[model samples]
Target: MKNISLRAGRFLTLGLVLTGLGLGSCKKDDTTTVYGNWTQDASISAPRSESVSFVINNVAYVGTGRNPAALSTNNVYGDFYALDPSKTGSGWSSVTPMPAAAGVRYGAAAFAINNKGYVCGGYGYVGTSTNITYLSDVWEFDPATSTGSTVGSWRKVANSLPTPLSGAVAGSIGNVGFVGCGFDGTGNTNIFYQFDGTTWRTLTNTYPGQPRSGAMSFVVNNQLYVVGGTNNNVATTDVYAYSTTSGWALKHYLRNVSNSTESYDYSAVSRSLGVGFTVNDKGYIAVGGSTLTTCYEYNYADDTWTLKNPFNGSARNNAVAFGIGNYGYVGLGYTGATRLNDFYRFAPNDAQQ
Candidate 1:
């Protein structure tokens, strides 16, 4: 499920300077209050984009994406890492890499369930520019059973997804994990599936939004919210929610629509491949396709979005994000053909300094 690649914009450095330091008369500068503060954290081991990430037992595991610098060789990453937000003093440590047999790939979907993390369904090049393979194989990573150097082990799941997919979004609610909506080689799809850590079952209902790929999914209040993605080559704004008990229903549109009262622009929220995570009962989407640093917060109670301070990092897409405790972590993405290793911790409710 490759995006209809948007051209990367050129990098420009901007600086702010305070004028009239010694002015005889001066006016007090107005203090503007802003929500959300991003603090830089440990960088990932390497720079890559379109990676997959999941959290298990408060530890984030990230791996498997394309490295822009390795394009000529068509090398995709299989190396994985683990970072515990409570113990960031140790930084990120390498976990066991994904199996070589799975074939290095990008645009995969990941979710954690039953204390284990699972990666499934992505597409990869087959040693040639013209040859691409869509994947349906599923792999599970168990950190508790790991050996030295935090090296976890992976095992292939017997029942993979029914069809090959890429650019899908995944999340787990209580004991059940859900995956849905991505390209299935021919075109984008709205199909969805659920796994109880063993067998896979197709959901009786498909996603109700436009068929999409590269959307963002995050769980808040035990409900799965699927928002923003490309449909028919254009970024979509529709937002949808699903719960095991209630099935699927359309939520507020990401843009300022008939339902919203806030005047702040939400057009920036319409994007694909952005990072989405929940913090302090609210959900945030940041850094995505067409290259943006803007971050938006979703309030499920009111079905509204509030713009936060822009991401402290450079504008990017295909970044990976995970929420632990009260903070959300975002990092490792592509900015203007440049793969980034820098990471940041965002406090969406904090006052920006």
Candidate 2:
């Protein structure tokens, strides 16, 4: 009987150890994968904000905007740069800059279709004549023919936005591209417009989104998600999603839950002009005004936000971001008095939680 009791105890011990190992394996498999940190990358040649960026044929291109050092003091660049993420050490290559007549300025909207890129709108100031000029011209850049280090060529599109826009956002879905919500000189407009390679048609669908500028847009699963920006001097947490099925509807609120009553608290510092980009099906937004550094991830399927890794870079606003393959590149923006030029690449890892 004593021998039998010892054998039973050993069996129990083995059973417990096996069960613990099985539970550990279950935890590892059950945990939802979170993303990783932002790895610093080669910096762009110039630090800027209110600029525009788009991807075509797996290459990312950025250009046009006033530099922080010269903003309001007199200086805006039409300079363009291109980067191949697969070859990060090669850095950003200088493309042909925008011409004077093109009005290559900040706050403009940009998108890519069929391996070509289009840039339109933005506030223009050349040499301190305080009159404030907004642009409605449109130009298309094609890098398909360029060989080696040579940049692309640009030709003016036949059609342009009927109303001049600044601080607008642009994105592409399928074969067409769309532009929306910009400051049209007098005030903010909520009009939605799309371009089909040649013609520009304004969609009459009234986007209930606050008519404000500095908002940013990103694409995930062929849908466009527009996030926070200022509307009528008040910053907002209103987040909207637009697609063919629903023209435009509020998706998820960009706020945290309040301890009291467990209600959605809309009072987070407004994340206007923050950088936004997508990795896989998840969209990540971070580092805008109000000295914000907390990054939030939006799950479109569930409409819930989960905290991801905070931007490991300096806190800033009015930054620009674009994704290539699975990685998102964020860089160049204003930090109150200073403008930042540091660029970083983000990759989501499963253990980020």
Cα lDDT, all candidates: 0.82, 0.75
Error of 2 at 26 (Å): 18
TM-scores, all models, native as reference:
0.86, 0.83
Give per-residue CA lDDT, model 2, range 129-245, as digits (tens): 445588787888998755345678887899988889888888888888888898899999878788988999887677787798778788887888888888887776788888876
How far in Å is the alpha carbon of 157 misplaced in model 2? 0.9
Off by over 4 Å in 2: 1-34, 69-74, 125-132, 147-149, 256-270, 350-353
Name the best candidate (by TM-score): 1
TM-score of decoy 1: 0.86
Instruction: Give the top-scoring candidate (lDDT).
Output: 1
Model 1: residues with Cα > 4 Å off, grouped in runs: 1-32, 69-74, 125-132, 147-150, 258-265
lDDT of 1 by residue, 1-353 (tens): 11121111111122111233453235644333457889999998788888999999888999988887555325577779989888748898899987766667788999999999999988775334445588898999998887555678888899999998899999999988999999999999999999999999999877778889989989988899999899898888888999889899887665643323323335657888788998868988898876688787888887767667778989888899999999999999888879888899998878765
Report the CA-based lDDT of candidate 1 relative to the real structure. 0.82
